[model samples]
Structure formats: structure tokens, C-alpha cells
Target: MTTQQSASLGLQAETKRSSVNTAPEAPPYCGGDTPARRPEFFTTVSSLLKDADGVTVAVLRIDSPPVNSLGSQVRVALGRELDAALSDDKVKAIVLTGTGRFFSGGADVREFNTSKTKVEPLLRTLIARLEQSEKPVVAALNGTTLGGGLELALGCHDRVASPEAVLGLPEVKLGVLPGAGGTQRLPRIVGVAAALDIIVSGDSMSAEKALRYGLVSEIVQGDLVDGACRAAAGMAKGVVQYRRLSHKPLGADAASGQLFDDARKMAARKYRGGIAPMHCIACIEKALSCDLDEGLAFEAEKFQELVNGDQSKALRHVFFAERQAAKIEGVSREETPRIDKVGVVGAGTMGGGIAMSFANAGVPVVLLDSTDEALQRGLGIIRRNYEATLKKGRLTQAQLEQRLALITPSLDYRDLSGVDMVVEAAFEDMGVKKSIFTTLDAVCGPQAILATNTSRLDINEIAAVTKRPGRVLGTHFFSPANVMRLLEVVKGDATEAAVMAGIFQLAKRLGKIPVQVGVCDGFVGNRMISHYTREAYFLLEEGATPAQVDGALRRFGMAMGPLQMQDMAGLDISWAARKRQAATRPAHLRYSRVADRICESGRYGQKTGAGFYRYEPGSREPIPDPEIEALIRECAEEAGIRQRPISDEEIVQRAIYALVNEGARIVEDGMAQRASDIDVVYVHGYGFPAFRGGPMFYADTQGLDKVLATIRGFHAEHGELWEPAPLLVRLAEQGGRFSE
Candidate 1:
């Protein structure tokens, strides 16, 4: 038990002064046992793991400098300390745990490959020393035990865990098998079928479930370290019993592992083309057929295959990219403002949904509209979304009522006072949004920040009308804002760093991931749309039907094809924008002309019952319209465009590269901070496959050189739309990444 957390009643020795010199201090991120430790960044690890009370039931607490990763220093210190304790005759039992909320976040990914050769030898010595100790060993799983941390815990004689603990060997999620004794020991303990499930899926399990599976010997009701000590004390005198996982005989024979065969069949179907899941299956097979050491050897081999692999490296890059993308220059994270109260202007789908996002995060929301009917409709939608959550067991009735109470619907601008921020989610028109901001500027206090939920309009233009333009920014939430994780925080020309910081903090308060962007029409999300749409049109003209192109892109993991997405979103939107684009075509962009012809007719989209695809009432199924096909042919004739057979490869390449090209342009224009930021937007807001990473990531992986080559070829054939970015061309030629 910790003074910083819950105190224990059983400290025989009186607590002494801080052991700054004698003991290793806990780092800031790891946390410590002091009043000052309440603020995580201030706590020193030295105070948390003081050697003053180093005793028989010593819990080797780990919360490594940050993210408690199992790197070289951690491994060395842990092994050395445990060895010293085991050698001391007075030490009867050792209980290992971690500080604060987490145990260890597995092995330190940064040191992985560099320490690969040394890993097996170190692990063998550590496991041997721990297992062969005259003193009993107990592992107190304080929080998440994943990868090698789980392996270390599994090696102990007894396992005791807290209720909040999550246990698993989740290396496979990063496309690698658990390298340290996972495949062998886990299957031996939990049976082949259960072990395979965790290993293959790379999914974590609750401590309660782990207890049911007999993974942990006991569960802690109160403080975790105390429970661990009690268990260790019991086992020290032979009161607690445990079976070594390596020595346990199977309940059923080896051939009885037909259960695993069936599981593998299902796993293969579930995890198609993925290597780690299959490798996990093979590890399970080896565990059933051979001894523990043999199984561990097999696991090690598979781990090597994964560790040296390109996929795992790509996954690791993405993992780090997500963490790094959150940093904002000139914005002090220490100055994060509290977003307890919010105002939502508009009683439409976006406003209602965004209001729900705030309420879900325990912030009160004031929803405003012109009439009670519109306000009631927005409230009704909020209620329905919460009701759906209730049905899914995600929200309790009491919790739902508490959240619903947070949202106060009103029709007057006077009610918007005393709010930290106001999100104007009104219609996507400049005049309406500007008028709302103008009204908000006069009504709200000087400190209140104004945010517009506009998708394509310029944030700078919206902020231009406000008295305090520095406080005006764009919080562009995707459709169904509550459900979508991505929030693009557009920093206007005059937006102050504090205001930008507040919007980012507000986004975090709403349980949304925020990526800061610069002001521009369509910003990052829709700008990329031009490329994909152009390719779709080119495909249609080249004798490929809309169905063919749609099928190809959809098969490649896009939720919908470019044409299909246009139809679903209503083509008239782009059609209206295209009219302006056409007037300034040579100045803005090169013309494609294919989409204009489709839109010039009364073909709006699903809303108009006709576009690229025909729709039946109340149905999502898209039927390719032959009428559109005939029109395409006629348009090709009128435009004197040559019609020819198109390949699926051409369709996929042309469409996707257009997106990459546009992204390069966005990056070069300083609209985006980094290429990875763009990827994050697409990954969350758009349906870019997680496995393939996002578009920018995908481009990086494809070898920028190769991408540039494709773009160059497209440029020669198709003109300015295919013109590669100067930066992109340079990076590609230098054999570097877009993010780099």
C-alpha cells in the first residue's frame, strides 16, 4: 500500500524520512508516494521505491520513467535488485508490482531490436533466479500486464491481482508474438484453446476473467500491494499452494487439442493475411506437441520473424506517430483551461451530436435554436442516441439521466453567457455562421472562445466578423460528432495560442482526439477528395463502369468508393462548389469536367434519388444507373475525349495517387504541421484502414520514391492535377518519409 494511494495497516516498521540517496527515486511520469505526487509530473521515483523498508515481502514496484516500459535499464535494475533480495536469508517472499495506474507497458519498443540478441540470455537468467529462489515468489499485478511483463508475472509461483488489472500478451496486436515465455507458459497454464485466443487476437482480458481462467491465484479486494503481501506471507509458510505452469499435466491428452484446430480455422478466417495470428497458432501447436522449452524456442523464432519484419516496424512508427501528433508548439500544456460549461448554437444533427459529446465528458451543455420545436427535435435525437447506448449496456439509466440533465435547451442568445466556449454548429453557410459569431461576440464575456463547426468555410473569414478574433477558432466535428473521434481544430489567422490551446483542451474534454490545422477551404479532409473524385471520373471515361471502380476501391478497404461517397453525401454540394471552381478553374485547379456534367443535370445524390447510383427509399444499397452510364458515353463524345478499356490497377492507382498528390500540396502550403497529422485525420474521420495505416503512412510505406514515380508518370499523362509537390519529390528522391 502507498501513502499516495491507499495506506496499509500492517507496516511493522515506522515510516522514516525520504531516502533520496539510498533508494532509486520514481521518475515524474511513474509517480511517487507523497502529497506532491498527486500531481504526477512532480513525483520522483526515489521516494516511491525507497530501500528503507526493503524486506521479506518486498514488492518490486515498476513505473519506469514514463509509460513504464521494459527497456535495458529497467531489466538490469529489476534483475539486480531481485537477486540481492533473494540472496538475503531474511527475505522470505518477494511481491512484485507497479506504481500508480499501470504496471509495465510491455518491453520498451525503442530498445527492442538493439537488445534483441541479449534478450534470451537475460530472460533465462532472470527466470531461473526467480524460480529457483528459496523464498516464495508472488506477482502482484497492479494494472495492465502485457508482453514481457505478463511473462515475468507468469514466471512467479503465485499471482495476485487487483480488480482494475488487465492481463494479456498483446504483442501480436503490434504484429509480433509474445517473445518472453508467452506461447509456452500461457498455453500450459490456461489450456491451448484459451491461450490461442489471447495470442492470436492480441486482445486483453479483465482481471475477473483472468481469475475465472485460473490465471491468477487470488484477487485483491482492497490495496493491491497488501493483497500481494498477504498471499506471499501465506505461501511462505506453505498455506498457499500453486502449481508450476511448466509442470502441470493436461486435463485432456495432446490429441484432445482438436479444440485448437477449430479455433485456428476460425482465427484464420478472422485474421486473414495477417502473419502474427498464424504465428500464434503455430506457437500453440508447438506447445501442445512439445515441451515448454521447445515451445519457447518456437515462440522466439516466430518473434524474430516478426521483429525483423516490415509490418511490425510500420506499426511501431504509427504508434509513435499518434503520440507525437498531439504536441502543439507555443502552447503550454500546463495552461490547459477547464471546459466545465459549453454552449451549442444550432439544433440540428451536428449541434445535437456535438452537445452529446460534451455531456458525455461530464461537461454541461446549453443548446440553442430559434424555436422550441427545433430545440426539442435536437434534444430528441440526443435522447435516442443515449437510448441506443442504454440498449447496448454502455450507459446506465441513472448515468443517462445525469447526462441528459447536463444539456439545457434554450432559444435566446442571452442564455449563452457564463460559458467557457460556444460551438456554433448551425447550417454550413457563411452568413449564418458569421451572424451567429457576431451575436456571440456581443453577448458572451471577453474570455469566452467562439468555435465554428464549419466543414469547408474559412475559419479566418468567420473570425473576421468577431470583436475578439483571437478567441475565434474552428472546431470542425465530423457528422455524428458524438460518435466520431476526430476533431479538427482550425487555428485562424488571429487565433491566440491560448485560444488554440483551449480548443484543444476542450476537444480532450469531449473525449475526442484533436489535430490542429490551418484555415483553408475544405482543410485537409476534403482537399484530398478532389484527387479520388478525379480518378473515379477518369475510370468512368476509360470504359470502366462506376460499379467496377467502386468495387475496386471498396475491396481495398475504403468504406465507400469516391463516386458512392459523393452520392451518399449529396453530389449537389460539390456541384454548387464546382460552379465557383469553374469560374476560377485556371487559378485554383485544373478542371476534370466529368463531375460537372453529372451534376449539371438534376442529379443531386441519394437525396435527389439519382446521381452516380440509384437508390430506393430508406435503403443504403446502391444500384448502378445505366442512365448515368449512357450519359457518360454521350459526354465523352461531346468533349471529344477518347473512350478506352480501363484496368482495375489503373483505377486504384489513379484514384489513390490523386489523394496523395493533394495531401503533398496541403503539406507544402503549411496547412498541415506534419504528414502524420494528415494521416490521423483520415484514419479517424475517413475510413482509412488501420492495418494499412493512414494515407500518408501508406505512402511512406510504399516507398516515397515509388509514389513519386507513379505521380510523375500520371503528370506526364494527365497534366497539373498529377504535378507532384516539390517537397514530396525531394523527400522521395532522398529516400525519406513524408513525415520526415
Candidate 2:
């Protein structure tokens, strides 16, 4: 039979089975004799296709390339196709799916805060139409469906997914809640507890887990659109019932006030100072108390409140900043050679973590050390780290073994000869790094890129030691290289553009956020943090206790206080850097001997059980040490400095503004590309709270004029130690922002 005849027969069968009308009134072009329009007649972003198998189901396929984000154009097109499908008598059912790996990436972030977001047929409006459709509608989840994409699926009468599909409502990460009936309909389909966890945590669930959660009716083993069409045809033939998520009643647990109370408490503890999580909980609570329309209105209201709020704007800035940091003005991926095999030269914590990062990405790595003992030890540490992850159920034994096999331990440099790139994670000493690079220059092929994972030292000086200076650059991965997302790609004066571009691509392959920077002391993160740490130490000399200083910045949204971070990182590392710089240190510049004195007493932070704060055995918590407090007093006395009470406000301003001032210098000196790159480094690498943006962003928000005024006041009272950056002065004078 023809498609329209088949659909008519199915609609007649559905009508015979149900007391109420199952089909909508036909439109002008609904009959079998009406010629079907081409797929392109609908919208360019999507195509309308009738199932060739004569199933009487029309498949609306979204074909936007890349992520298939539901932007204004796609929304308008999808709405048009959906309307046409509803009107057509040949289309007994409709199946919505995407062209490739993404069903949809949700609302286009590029369209956010723009007039396009409010253009005709918003995502919410399109979803409303989907939910109210008389003809059965099914979502064929082909791949990753997230945020508004998942919400759109929830609006369908039924959902069927391929085994590879991933689903989530992750708007909370951007500091906004899902506004398109996700908060209301998700709970009705899944229980209140599951919905809260899914929405509030902003985590994706596997298609298998989605089936278990009842989010999808079936996991399609074959083609997703075909299976979805079959499911939709079943509904059309009265073999399956239409299940609109909006009309579904909430589970009995939704009535429990304790359930919501517990969710709120969990969100408070997990998100800590975050605004979206609490607002998400509030919307879910509305689902329990209010009708679907009322709940959806509440969700939209809350979404609007957050999308325009300061926290959300800051978070969105960070999201864009991270992506922008990867783009170089003249560099393109095609110019860079692909990095296939990697080599890591060292076996310590940093080196081992670097090795694991490569292995995790399924790249073969040569982990070279001077001796078998150190190599074995590094390999042991790597295995232990993987074992810990396995115990957490995050890694399976087979996967752990597979990752471990990717890393080949070696005692000879010859093993790294064929590797595309080598990351030197050896000792921080310049001589040690220079010697390694010299040997690598001769031993490895000329095409291999040499990278130093140096935090503070000059990359230019290191590059000068190599014959092929063009091939040498710095890939300064943060401590615990496998865990930290930030990778500062420091380009030296003589480094080739292709080398820098290659490392940038390698950083993406390794799942690191790469920020290109120029050579400087401590590069971007550490250079700026040096001033922040200096201010913290200066605060201690001026009468702020460790607890008070740490508490102040912690309240300011720092992940941890500076002193605690130093303690956790081991004081010996920075103490060594100080000793190296002692000869060149300016006599006029004020130096704090507090850290040196603590190091003299054999206190090297958490590893040694003492530093600025004492740690009890088996605990990471910092306990104030009276001995260190006494040392601070003695240093102040020796320096002939008077101590006075310092408020938390002063502590926060001094510490944070110190970072801001130095960041301004870095930007002006061309060490960093832009002010936002500094923010990206600090937020991703230095634990400067993402919600506050970064130090530079924070300074802009506080007003550069006011910040410069505070710095000038400090500079007058504290000599050149508090010298305001020239860039800050000019910007402040011009009433401009660092971000601008």
C-alpha cells in the first residue's frame, strides 16, 4: 500500500480502539492525492523524510553540523517541520532525530543574551507544541542530547535511544537552570530524587542508565530513526499508548517535603556559594506544589533571573574565555603535525601524572628515567593511581590494564627517539632542564618537539640551550598533570609557529585547556600568584593569623587560602626558588623571611606534617602552628616593622588586588595575550573561583578606578613594593576595564 493509504488505515484502527479521536483534523494538503513537498521545503537546518518502508512515520532530522545546537534558525525550521508533519495525513507519526553524533547540544550559547533567543518559536514554545501533538511523536536520540535538547526529548510522547546516546540537562554548570519544562516534566517521568540528582548535578547519564531511569522507553539496537519510527508507528496503530511526560503524575515521593529539603542541603554542600543549584531545587519543588503550567512559568522565571545575574555572566565569560584561549591569531591546526607517540622524561609525581595523561588519551608513551629503580617507582605510582580509580568504580580492571599498557617504561633515551613529542618533567633546576634538552636535541629526531613542564623558569633561556631552538617550547602542566585542566603553552622568542600550534593541538588531544603565553618568570599563573602569595605573607607580618588570612580569601571564594595551598604544595619547592633568586634579588624590594624561617625549622608543608600550619597524621586539615606564629613575630621585629590588627576585608583586598596588579603588568608586557587569558589561567589552574571570574575580571567589576586608588594608597604607605602596574594606572585614568 502507498504511505498515505497505510497511515489512513492505521489512524482508522487507532480510532476504533479509542473512545476519543486519536487523529487531528486534516489540513488542506492532507489527502493521499496531495503531492508531497521536497524535504528542503521545510527548513534548511532540518530535513523532513517519510519512512521509505511505508511505516507512515515522518522523520524530522536536524542536520546542523558540529553540535547541532538549537539556534534560532534551527528552532524555526524544526517548528515548521513539526507543524507540517502534524498536518499531513501521510505522516501518521513523527520521529525527531539529528543527522550525526549529536541529537542537539541544547540552545546555542552564541545566541544567548541575543535577540535571536527571543526570535519566533523559542525552544520552550516548540516543546509545548511537541507535548500537545495529537499524533504520536518520538525522539530518536542518536547521540549526545543535552540541556534544551534533552528537554525537547522530554516533550515527546515517547523516546527511543541508540545504545551510544548520552543524555543530560546540564544548564546548572553555566549557572542557569533548564527553562523549557525540564524541571517540571523530568520529575514526572523520573522520581523526584532521580530528577533532582540528574538536573542539579548537571551530569550526563548513559543510554543504558537512561533506560533504567525510564527516561527512554527502549534502547534501539539497530538504526535509531528506524527503531523510533517503528515505536511511533506502533502508537499510530493503537499497539502503544501515547505517554506525554507533562501529563504524567509525579511519583508518591514528590509529596515529601523532606525529599526537597535533603536535595537543597545536598546542593548547598556540593555547589557551595553557587546560585543555580538552589534555584534548580526551587523549580523542582514547584513541580510538586504547582500544576504543569505554573511550574513551567516558575522555571522560566528562575532561568531568566539567573541568565542575567552576575554569577551567570561570569560563568559564561569563563566558558567562552577557555575556548578563546585556544585560538591563536596566526596559528592553525593544519600547520601543525599530528602528535601520535609521546615521551615523558621523569618518574616523579609530576612526570608520572603526565605519563598517565597521555595513556588515558589512548596514545602510546615512553616514560624514560635515569635508572630502572626510579622508572619502576614511577610506574608503581601510576598503577596505584589507576587502582584507586578502579576501587571508586570509575575504571574497570580491563580498562586500567589497557591504559597501563599504553605507557612503556624505559631507562634509555633511545626509547623516545621515534616519539612525536617529549615533555621534560624533570627537576626544576635550569641546569638539569638544559642538560636534558641538550641530550634530547641530539638523541631524538629533528621533527620531535621538546617541551619543558617548568612552572617558573624562563623558557627562552631553556630554548637557547638546544640547537633547534625552534622546536623547544614549554608545556607547563599544572601539578597533578592528569587532573589539572590548565596547560600553559609558553612560546619562546625563537620557538616555531608550527611547534606552538602542534602543542596546542596536543593539549586538546590530552584533554587539557591550552592557553598560549609568552616567556616570563613563573609564566602566567605562577607569576601572578607570586604577588598574591607575597601579599599573604606580608599580611602575616602585619598581624593577620594564618587562619584569618586563609579564612578571608576562602570567604572571597578562593578554593583554599594561599598559606594552605603552599603547605599542601610543599614549602621546599618555593624555598628553593627563593634561594636561587637570592643573588639577583633587589636589595630595595621587601622580602618576607617567614617562609624561609619555617623551612629552616624543617617544616615543608603537608608532606612534612608542618609548614605555616601543622597537620595531624592522616589528616589534610591544617592546624595553626604557634611556632610559625612566633617566627612571624620574630621576622617582623628583625625587619623593624610594626604589627597592627588587619581586618578580613584588608586581607582579601591585598591578596586579590596583588594578583590583579601583577596580571595587569603581565598583559601590558605582552607575556599574556589578553586580560581574559589571565582570568582563564587563574580560574582553571590557580583555583580563583570561577563564579568571581578571575582576578582581572574581579578588578574590572570592582572598578579599575577604585582598584588603582587602593593600590596608590598602598604604594604611598608601603613604598615601591606596592607599585601599581602602569597598565592599571592608564586604564583607571581612562575609566576603562582590563577585559576591554
Candidate 3:
């Protein structure tokens, strides 16, 4: 029989079966009566039933909770249901959907490297079966459809989605291109340029955009499953054609070499040193040039290659590490308290940023300063920041006003009495922090959690000033707090478990990654960064120029070179800390006076337009300075040290390994709960590249034995500064990994 004839007969049989199975007294199979043939196998990962249309449109709902990830069980269940629907004389069409907020979150990331991923009827194989189905399939996208989930939808003969649904192919974010037919089929529907943007950028597209791109046939007004079933019924009745995406021809632009070339260039610029974007472009090019089967095979080949590569491993490690950072050993999320209002003390850059962080999250904030001038200045700066976002079209005028209104500036300490929490972003002085806490204890309610935004001050001592020490902890928000994602929750000795839990929950509400660290000087990120910067300064003292040292690190995927970053952050800040520690400094230990001398000259970095590098007026770009080069030589000569040529290899090892060594010490000292937590801090707070999986994970990738050997060599040549941590020594001896 012809395809149309078969579909017509199937429809007739479906109507008969629906009438016979669904009783007249019952509303429908969904409401009262059970379907006549409810398969036991479908109860686990999916459910099968007839739609309200009284036609046998087999509604196969993915029942996996949370995100309907297509794990082995889910894939197997879905395949069996598809087979059952196809064989059933009563079922004329199929409607695939999912329960909860996600149509599917794609493949199970938990099964990425495991044996289950290679099981028979893999996602690719199941999608092939779906594409070749004789009966039409309609995808009912209820919510988020991403990665392999989007790929599955493309295999369907037709697609309809709820207005709230979002779709994307975001495999490149996990360091792999789309392995299924996403690279090939997406281009067939959305054209080559649009597909390249979607897949390479790994950003989600809204249902409206999906409709505009022809990715979804229609946006359902009411019930998504009902609309999808109606669409399926139309195809079964031959009113709508069962159009296969595999048979669709590539657009005319697909043949343009320049198109692919431009995409490759854009990918390189946007995703520097990333291999996945380049590979994604290659797969899309294959779709343009090769047949569907060949393109799919090539995509799978590339996917397997990337998934097994070191970059993908590191990326995946980071993906899990971020989630792992949220958990505390003794604290449950139930202990967390609601924080409706927050008070930020101090009206400088850090203080203003902290207030903006709360205001952006829809939390009311009281921004307190010592004087009216300072308070207005801080509020003006916040307004300017929001105005800049508005200019970029990221914020509407009403949103900008709403955020600004959330921050109420004040000079009186009494304004903080009713706040749920108070974060004192004051100067980095124990005396000053103590004074603020002492006042806060008297002025604020007993239940209010008091926090200090100190980078390195002893939090235990700060807690000593307050009567309710259990309510005191440290909330170290990174600079430009609203922009940076890290919030190091410092758990002081007397800090209550509930306080820690509360801060962690609040950090998430503010869109920050909170890593719980025990109280210590500089905590994890700053303590490790102290060693990193020390090595960078030492490299300069040893004959590496500012450009050479920074260049080497930049080549290693650092966001900015050490000297340039110092320049941007201002050199005066570290100069004060060094000066404070000078009296207690051990004379025999090496110290770089380069930064101090720069500060003495009043060239405190970009603020002064001259430090390690010179800058033009109104520009932040660092220019190589001959004056600073001469100063480095003078400092070296004064210390009676001879400068020697340094290799870029040595530069990277000293800088990165310094972070690794100190991170190990922090973990051992109990300042950091685990090595991966240190990685989270650096990756989120310190601009450490996520692709390298942060410092500790990078050390693991280099092998503990290899890292120990490098450190031992440095120790022999450079004295105590390069001494390997005991944990590193023990791990190296045991052939263990820091990541574990």
C-alpha cells in the first residue's frame, strides 16, 4: 500500500480502538478509565496513553524527574514504547514529551565516560529509529530542550512547543560538539549561519525565536500535549505531510567556503584556544558538503574524540566541581534562613558593588557610609553602573530604576537594625573591622547575621568583638561583586552552622558560587594568589620583563598576566599590606621591593598611569615601560642579586605551581574543605581558566609525581619558597591525584 493509504487505514483503526477502549461514562483514558493495553515496561521512564482527540495518538511522556536525561534506562524505555506504538494497529501517530520543567536536559552527563553510554540503542541509534518511523512523530516541547534533547526533536516528523519552551544545542560548552544529528539537522532547518551561531555559542533560543527559525512548526496556545496530538493527527490523516529533516536540502549559502571560513574565524576570536568550537564548525561544514549518514558518522567520530580528550575531561570535572562546592559537611540546606533585607557598610567601590549585588537579586539593601558625601558618591556610582547596563540593552529603564530603588543610602547606623544581615566592606584593618562589628552588635538585632568582607583579616578576632559571635562570619565577595560570581563564605571558629547554611543559600540567590572555607589569613583564593603573585614578582627580579612574564601566563590561558592584573587592581593595595608585615618579616627570606618602590614614586598603577606598565590617558591598556624596567634592575642590584634569562616554560611552572603548592597547603590546613573547592575559588574568583579545571585540577592533570619533581627541582635551586607541600609529597609518593 502507498504511504497515504496506510496512514488513512491507521487513522480509521485508531478511531475504532478509542471508541471501544474509552467508555461513554468515563471522560477519557487520562481522567477516569485506564487505557486497555497499558504496557508494564513503560511505567518506569515513560507513560503511554491515547490523546483527547479520540484518535490513537500514542502520547509517550518521559517521566524522569528533575531533568528528563536520556540515560540508558530512559533510552531503552523510549525505544520500546516507540516500537509498541508503531506495531499497534490502533496507534496512528506518536507524541513525544516530558514531565516537569524540562522536555529533556539532553544526555545524562553522569554517564558521559561510563559503559552505559555505549549500550545498544544509543541515543544516535534511537534517533535513527525515530527518524525512519513509518508513522509520523510529533515532539511536544514543554520546557527546556537542549543538547541531545534538541537532537531528538529534530528527528521527529513535526514539532510543536509551549510558549515557555527553550531550545538549544549546547554540547560545545562541555567541550564537545553535538554527536547526534544536531550539527547536520539544525543547519537543514535554520540555515548554516544561524546553526553555526547556535551550536558554537552554546546559548539557548526561546520558543519565539525557534518558531521564527522554523525549528518548531508552531507554538501551542494552551495544552502542549493536546496541540502536539492534534498535529500528529493531521499528519496521520494526510492533511499535513510527514516531512523528514534528513531529506531536506542544505541552503544555498551552505556551499560558500567563505561562510565556513568566517565562522571559523569568529569561533577562534570568541572561544580562544578552545577545540570544541572549531570541531563544531567542522561538523556543520560536513553537513553542507556530505550526505546525512556521512555527516552523522563524522559528527559521532568527532564527538567521541572530544569526549575522551583531556580538555573535555577538565571541562566535565569543572561542571561537577561547581555543584560540589555548594555542599558543607555538617550543614543541611534546611538550616538556611530567609534574608529579606541586607545592609552594606562603607561607601567605596567594594561597598557599592556589594550593595548592587543584593539589589540586583531583588533584595532590599541599606547602603551606609561614614558621611553624606561618600553615601551620595556610592549611590551615583551604582546608578552609573545600571545606566551602562541599560545602554547595552541588558536592562530596561524600569528595571534600572527598580534596582536603584532597592538600594537606600544612609549615614546612620540605626538604619541597619531591621536588616536580616549586615556585610561590612570596610578597610582591611583588624582595628577598623572590630570597631564596625562592635557598633553593629549594639545597633542591629540579635538575630541579624554580621559579616565582614575582609580579604585576609583574622575573622575569629573580628567575631570576638561581638556578643553573638555565632552570628558572625566572613563574606568575601570578589571585586566588582555584581559581575564576579565567587563568594567565599569564611566559617569562623565561633560561626554557627545555620549561619553558614544561610549564607550559602543567599549566595545562590545572588547568582554567586559560594565555597565554604575555614577562617584563615587570605583564606583559599587570596592565600594561593599571594604565592602566585610572589612568583610573578620573583620572575621579574630574576630578569623576566613585565611583558614576558605576563605574555607567558596569557599563552597558558590566563585571563590576564600577573603584572597587568596588578596594574588594573592598583599596586597601592598590596604595598600597604607589605608595609604592615615588614616589621615581622624574616630578614633571610626573599622579598620583592618592586611594588613598594613603584608606590613610593606615586605610580600606583592605572590610577597613576604608571606602574609596571605605562598607560595612556582614559585608557586601561598597559604599555611596556622603560622606567619600570630600569627600576627592576635597580631593585635587583640593591639586593646584590644577579639577573638571569628566564624561559616561558619556567615562567608558567613557577606561577601555576605556586598556586598548586599553596592550594595543597590550604587544603591540609583545613582552610579549604577539599582541593576541588580551591579550584572552584580560583576558577570563579581569580580569573583562572575553567578549561584547565582550575589550579588544583590542573596539578592533577600534570600528574602529582611530575608536579612534585618540578617543585623539588625549584626547591633545590631557589630555596624555601619552592618547598613542596607535605600533601603534595605524600600524594606523589602514593601516585595519587589532587582532584580525587
lDDT of each candidate versus the true structure: 0.75, 0.84, 0.84
Worst 10 residues of 3 by lDDT: 24-33
User: Could you tell me how far off, in angstroms, the CA of residue 179 lies in candidate 2 after the best superposition?
Assistant: 1.2
TM-score of candidate 3 on Cα atoms, chains taken together = 0.93
Which sections of candidate 3 miss by over 4 Å? 1-43, 52-54, 248-252, 255-259, 329-334
TM-score for each candidate, following the candidate numbering: 0.87, 0.92, 0.93
The regions of model 2 sitting more than 4 angstroms off are 1-43, 49-55, 246-252, 255-262, 329-334
Q: List CA RMSD, all candidates.
A: 4.8, 7.2, 6.6
**Candidate 3 RMSD to the correct structure:** 6.6
Query: Which model scores highest in TM-score?
Result: 3
What TM-score would you give candidate 2 relative to the actual structure? 0.92
Candidate 1 shows a clash count of 7
* Superior by TM-score: candidate 2 or candidate 3: 3
Ranking by TM-score: 3, 2, 1
